[model samples]
Target: MDTIISIIVPIYNAEKFLASCIDSILSQTFKNFELLLIDDGSQDSSLSICQKYQQNDNRITVFHKNNEGVTAARKYGVEKAKGEYISFVDADDIIPENSLALLYKEHDNADMVIGNFIEVMPHYSKKNKLYSPQVGRFNGIDYISLQLENKLYHAPWGKIIRKNCFNDDIFTTPRDIFRGEDLIMNIKLGLNIKDIKIVNTIVYYYMIRPSSCMQSRKPTLEYEKMFDRFLMLILKRNKLDTKLKKSILSQRIDALTGLLTEKIHLDKNDTFVKMIYSQLKISSFDMRQILLKTCLSHPSIFNILYRVYRKLSSITT
Candidate 1:
């Protein structure tokens, strides 16, 4: 019989948790999947670990290539995958034994199946109590709205996507835009897919490492550019109604605000921050008009107000 699913795990410097991730996939109740371990030029012993697993498991395939990024590794995996359904797993994370089985069971009903995940901290592993519809199918617009609202996560790891939904044009963004690649890619996939299913089961375990890319304090212009382009793309979609466009615009503005305040530290004096501020001022969406104007016109005052807002927000939460 042909492979039912192809699981792609992009490996970088995750030697500490690689074995556990591989073990989780190997122990899955669905035994008819091939595991593709793409070693993205890790400086550590990650490649050796992948090779060791490849030797032990006949279904495991290992590919070694120059360091490109997770996006490139995933593209390579998809190119070589032969399964009817495709799923991704980060090397630092693990999925439940029934994760693949449950997703595959629903494969015939929808183009995509998304499962819930728990955030596992370094010191304490806590199961996240997230509320999601028990089992619901949605169109592309509603699915994207759920994702924008944070009800549905944007990561590729916890979802099972049918191979037919992917085309040659997916994941074409520049490799440097690492922060929100999953969001952009999933948006593209959601746009193409007709039916999407939400499964309330907690299937994947996401490790919240302090040094993860999402938590990094380093400034990168690629993330701002990516978000800008994402918003523009969504706005240009003629099929989207005014209500959906407004919802998407509002969510994207919030994302841009976080980029400016949290990641970039709101340094209006910095050249990159200034460039971002200028771009936000001329954004097509009116939702960000006032905030951008305030920040650009009186940065110091805006900073003070922002600080107060954060304090009040913390208190309310």
Candidate 2:
């Protein structure tokens, strides 16, 4: 029987968790699938571990390349993917046994099949199991609106996408924004996506680490620059409506708030905050509308107080 799905696992220095990760996939009841293990120049025993698996199972193909980022590894896997359905799984994460079965059922009618994921800690610590809401079938308008509100913009691993969703032109190109590159990649895929599904069944296990990007110290300019690129992508698409425009803008404000709050040193004469504020005003993001209608409903005084608190906190500590 032909394989229906291609699971792309980008391997790095994750030898500690690699065995269990592959085991979960191997244990899947749905047997018709190919596992592409791209070893991205791991200095540890991860490469050797992958080699052992490839030797044991012909269904698994191991590709070794020089030290490149996760994006590059995924791009390589996508280019070499032969299955009709394509999915991504982090090397350190695990997939539920029924993940492929449920996703395949949903993919029959969906350009993209999105499933819920639970965040697991070390030693399989279970705290706050997370699952996505039933967003229902989304048209183009719903897709844009849900994305800007940060509701539908889930992790890349939870979804099984049609291979044609990423044509040669989209996934092969190199993007400048290396950090938070997932946002732009999702947007690019979503622009062409339709008949999407939002299921509550948790199909993915997301392992949290203290050294992950979300926990590390970063320069605010990286985020600012990335969002700037995101806005440019939005402009070029010309598909978002007025409501969706407002949602995107509101999120941008929230992003700016965090960027400015971080205690990072800037250039002697750099005015990134000022530049971001200027862009916000022209971006036509109506925060007031979002605040009145959503969870961001804070009074003007609260906004002022929060700003003051951040400024003082930044200086005192």
TM-score per model over all chains: 0.78, 0.78
Off by over 4 Å in 1: 124-135, 213-226, 234-243, 263-317
Report each candidate's C-alpha RMSD, comma-separated, in the order given. Answer: 5.1, 6.4
Question: How would you encode candidate 2's per-residue C-alpha lDDT over 1-317 as one tens digit per residue?
Answer: 77788999998998988999999998888888999999999999999999899999988999999988887888889988888888999988899998998888776568777888877776445575575565577764466566656776546798788887786444433455545567666666777777677777788888776545355546476667566666566645665645465666556655655543463433323464444344444234454333222222223344564665568645653
Cα lDDT, model 2, residue 235: 45
User: How many clashing residue pairs, candidate 2?
Assistant: 0
For residue 86, what is the lDDT in candidate 2? Answer: 89
Return the number of clashes found in candidate 1: 0
lDDT of 2: 0.71
In model 2, what is the error at residue 156, expressed in angstroms? 1.1
- Candidate 2 TM-score, true structure as reference: 0.78
Residues 1-317, candidate 1: write the lDDT tens digits: 99979999999998999999999999999999999999999999999999999998999999999998888899999999999889999998889999998887776668888887787776545554343443688877777677665556778888888888887667876655656667667767868889988877877888766556454545444566566666456546735536675456555556656655753545566554565455454456343555655765665565565776678655654
The residue pairs found clashing in candidate 1 are none
